[model samples]
Each structure stands twice: as structure tokens, then as C-alpha cells.
Target: MTAETSEPPAFLPGLELSRILYEEGVRPVLDAAHPGLAYAAARVGSGSEVLGFDTARSADHEWGPRLNLFLADADAAALGPAIRELLAERLPKHVRGWPTHFRSDAGNELDPVSGHMTATDGPVDHRVSVDGIGSWLRRQVGSPTAELGPLDWLAVPQQRLLEATAGAVFHDGPGTLTAARARLARYPDEVWRHLLACQWQRISQEEAFVGRCAEVGDDLGSAVVAARLVRDLMRLCLLIDRGYAPYGKWLGTAFARLPVAGRLTPVLRGALAATTYPDRESRLCEAYETVAALQNATGLTEPVDPSCRPYHSRPFRVLHADRFARALAATVTESALRDRPLTGSVDQWVDNTDHLTSSRLEVPE
Candidate 1:
């Protein structure tokens, strides 16, 4: 293509880019080189696009026409490298005008995943990956398959789980990829109840702190506590809907898509925007009551009163969040999870990037 025709492709969502690359570029190469190969192809994991919140700005780094290609254990071991090299030799300079290559000769092989898509005439250093589905699963969720136990769920991060399950799955020729995504889509009911309880327990641990901090003339600390509660409440709404919450970067974006965001957003914003402790308390209590009522509506357990009252003569209003915590915890019947403390999942207690993003990063019991 001429320089005039070679300007960077206008931004398409990364998932769409993956689709175009597969259909237009990768498929023919695979069909001719290894026909009848049993495999699954998808754009799952890592990128903001996987979670459907990527924008043009996302094109700036680690974004491109790329996807995961899964094969059976035998097929992956025997043919994976061949297929990867074959794509590099035959895939086009661009898939829908976005270069199919993610690395250049000048590129540092040790440079980490910059995801910088660049045009190339030599054998294209394309980003299509070919792997055994089991290996991929182990990297994504610390397992070889999607069947995770309760303790396993607690050890995995929601962000990792979201990445594993949220993105578009484009093909199911091997049949397991679709099933894997479905299995990991949400937690089991008992685990759900346990997590909901822990989330409420998180709020309870802090609801009184908001006012207490302000009373001690630490308005900043009060706001900080209020903000944490707001986040917990948002994540709680995600759990109530049986959806996985993304990490902090996209937490609000994911939360906004939830059914409760319309009612809760205003209250949450009011709490954050409040200038005084009384206003913060008033707005936060409204949020607590709203979410408390939502929990009751789920019928997860016997209804706890959703109204706000003073924090046991401490002059701060609260929903007595532990009541909701206890109520939800009562419904869990899974013996492994039953009577567990309020630690919730790894995401509930751990937010380190290195820890959260690692598949084998086990959390302490």
C-alpha cells in the first residue's frame, strides 16, 4: 500500500479486530496448512477490550489484532509451533488496515507485551497464539479446566476471572472453550452467598469509621472511608447480579452497567461529593439502605431491616451492615465455605498488581 493508503487504521474495538484477523487472514492459512484441525479461537483475557470498555485511547498500548487459539493437548504439542510460524509467513500486512504484526525487528524480544502493532514485509511477527486449552486455562485461572472449588474461587482474583470469561469467543471447533467460559462465568450459589456476606462485612468494618474519622476532625480520612464503602457497595451490586467485578480501573465502568447503578449512582455520588460529615453520613446511609433492600429482595436469606439508624448511640447513622453480613452468611450450605470468616475472594482482600494478575498467586487462608 502507498504511504497515502497506509495511515494507521481508524480505531476498531480490539475484539472486532481479532475477528477480522481470524476470518480474513488467519483462517485461510490454517485451512491450507492444517485442515480439519480441532481447535478453539477467541479474544479472551488481559486487554480492556476483553471487558468491552476499551476506547480509541486503548489503541495506544498493548492493543491490536490478536487472540488466543486453543487446541487439544496432543494437537497443541504436535502442531502449535508449526501453526504459529505458518501464520507469521502467510498472514497479511494488515487485517482491515490494522497491521497483523505486533512486533518489529527493532523491537526488543525482551520488551514485554507492548502490543505495538506495526507493518512488516518480512515474515510477519504476528500475535496469534496457539496453545493447548489446558495450558491456557492454567495461566488464566490457576486451573486446567473451569471447574473450580470454593477454596479455588477464594484464591482467584475477580479481575482474572473476568478476563477469563468476559471476552468474545469466536469459535468452538474443539468444543471445550465455550464450555470453559460458561463454567467460569459466575460463582456457585453458595459461594455467591458467602461472598455477598463478606462484601457486607467489608462495609460494616468501615461504615462507622466514616463518621468517626470526621468527628476526630480528619475530614480527609472520613472521605477516604466513605469512598471505600462506596466501592464495596458497587462490587456488592455486581455480586447481587451474579456478575464479576473488574479491578479498580474499570470497576466503575462495569458497575455502571449493572441494574442497580441507576438508583445507587446518585446516592454514591452524593456521598462522595459531600463536604461535611453529616452530609456524607446522610448520603452513605441512603446507599446502605438501598443495597440492603436489594440484598433482601434476592431472598438469599431472611430479610434484615434495610433502614438506617444511629450507630449504637455513637451519633452516626448506619444500616448495621453486620446484620446483612450475618444474614447472607447464614444461607451458605457448602461445608467447605460454611462458617468461613469474611475474607471473601482474593480480590476482596488483595489488590497487588503482581498478585492479582498472576495465575498461580495463591492467597493466604
Candidate 2:
């Protein structure tokens, strides 16, 4: 899903109500009839509602009475019919104030059950599987072999990925969700190291280009660089701190709520608003030191002073030039990018990142 079909409803309101239905309306049925079928948990994963960041404006269609049911494949297959029958007969006509806009067929589109239904919504909106940890692990981190390919990491929008990937898991039985969570909970240690290395390289590469952009008589473009610098800085913070950067809409919301938000916010804004290349350079250097301090306090990584100094030279700054070359060659995954070598194009870099984080598509791979 590119930027177009990425609108997800918030999670709490919908999740709370769905949990109620699962425990009271649905769980009892599973306990009585499908006792042999294990009950792991029910959760709401994708959508804005799950992220606790949706506004009232988010309530449109396909935004109410949804729940995900996870069971072993055999259990799901064996008890699928019974569960659906129970949902049809006993599942409340509506949850809280919202109608169970249950669509007739799991495959129904558009007017998809505005209310309630089984987890497996056939082609789209299928309840996720929690039968085992491996399956859930693949879904969470988005391994290519696990139904969805590696999220185009480079192309999918960040906000949508955050919304879909950051929701709550509500309930669980087998702890399959728990194990999978530990893996996808954050980037693996090696992956984080690689990304941090890449990000640092990126800033180094552009350090020399600040003047070039300024020379083009585009203060706006220079400002854009500053903004990008701020973004990367924050992303590094999240990574170093072991948090996934949420979608754009909820970035400030998410960032402000972090423990370091108070400290980092002012620095981030300062970098973004810096007017001159030298000023930006100084601000970023400060940002790096601040990040290093935080990393030390948290024991996230071993401290190492950056070899590159603040940009002070004008023509073909050696450090800046070297860092740029390194950043260009440090890509972790190609899923998000359209072209193999990004060529220092900001638009392409952002575009590819967005694509890589999008939700799994409906059409078969």
C-alpha cells in the first residue's frame, strides 16, 4: 500500500469493544463447543485506532467492530465453522454504541461488515494466526516468506507502517504472540547496528553538500536538508532507544510521549529551523553528542566519538565527501527503493522507505 490506501482507524475504542465481544460473546462459545480448539488470544493489529492516534474524523467505513482471532491452522480449520456459527448467532448485534457491520461474506468488499465477523475475512482483513510463534514472527517483522513480502521498506509510507505495525495485542493463551513479539518487537541487534551505521554515513555524506545546496540559491532546499537531518536524528534516537518510529501523523505524538522526548524535542526543532549550513552543522554535532550521552546512560551501545568534525570547509570537504560515498552504499534492504543505487535523491530515499513498511497486499504474491 502506497500513500494512497493507508488510512487506518485508531485502536482503543474499537479494541476495547472487540475484546469484550471476544471474552463474553465469543470466548464462551469457543469454550463450550470447541473446547478442543485452543484459544490463544484476540487482538487488533492494523489501523489508526490501534495506534491510539486516530481523530473523530477517522470514523468512516470499515472502522468498527473488528477483531483478530488466532488459533493453530488445524484448530482454525476444525473449529472455523463452529466459531463462525457462534459469532453469527451469539455475537452481539452491536458492540458498545457501534453496530456490528458484519458483512455477509468474508470476501465482501466496500461495505465490509461495518460491524462484527470471524477473524478470517477471507481475502482481506483475515484474522491473524497465532497458532505458533514462527507464523506470528513472520507476520510481525514482515519476512518475505511469511505471506507478505519484506514490506517495501523503502517505498511504503512511514505513518501507515507505524499504524499497522504498532497496535496492541490485547489477549493471548499459547504465548505465541509473545515470542513473535520479542523478535519483531524491535530491529534485531545486528539490523539496528547496520541501520545506525548507515544513517551516520548519510549525514556525513551530506555534510559537504550543504553549501552546494545553498549555492543553488535554494534556501528552501537547504531548509529541507535541515529538516531531513532532524528526521534522521529522531529516527536514530528511536532506534538507539529501541523504539520503532511510528507513522508521520503520530510521530510528534509518539515522540513527545517518549522518555527522552523532553530532551530531544528542542534539539530536533533547533536543527530543523537552523538557517545557515554552519549553524545546521553545529546543531547536528550537538545532536550526535546528545544521542551518544543517551546511548551511554541506557547502555544501548558502546560510545565512540564521530571521526567527522562539524562542517567548516567549503570546497569538496574531504570528510563530508567520504561520508556521502559511504552512506550511498549502506542500504540494508532494497524492498523500499525503486532503483538499486539511490544516487542521493531525497525523494527516492523517502519513497523507498515508505514502500518497505506498507501492509501486506490483497492480491496473491
Among these predictions, the greatest lDDT belongs to 1
TM-score of decoy 1: 0.95
Q: Model 1 clash pairs?
A: none
lDDT (10s digit) by residue, model 1, range 1-365: 22434567678889999998888888888888888988888999898999989998887567888888999878899988888888888888887777776654355667555656677778878878898999888888878787888898888888899998888888889789898888998998888999999999998888999989999999999999999999899999999999988878899999999888988899999999999999999999888888888898998788789999989979899888999888888888899889688888888887677788777856457
Q: lDDT of candidate 2?
A: 0.52
Model 2 Cα lDDT, one tens digit per residue, 1-365 = 11224443333465666576677666776677766565556554556667766655545544555666766666666666656655665555544544453334445686555433323222223232233334443444344223232332322233433443455665667666545444344544434444455555566555555557877777778778767666766765676676766645555776777778788788777778888766665666666667656544644344344434635655422234234324333434444332333332222245444443445422212
Can you give the TM-score per candidate against the true fold?
0.95, 0.67
CA deviation > 4 Å runs, candidate 2: 1-12, 102-166, 274-285, 296-302, 306-312, 315-354, 359-365
The clash numbers for all candidates, in the given order, read: 0, 36
Ten-residue segment with the worst summed lDDT in candidate 1? Answer: 1-10
lDDT accuracy of residue 128 in candidate 1: 84
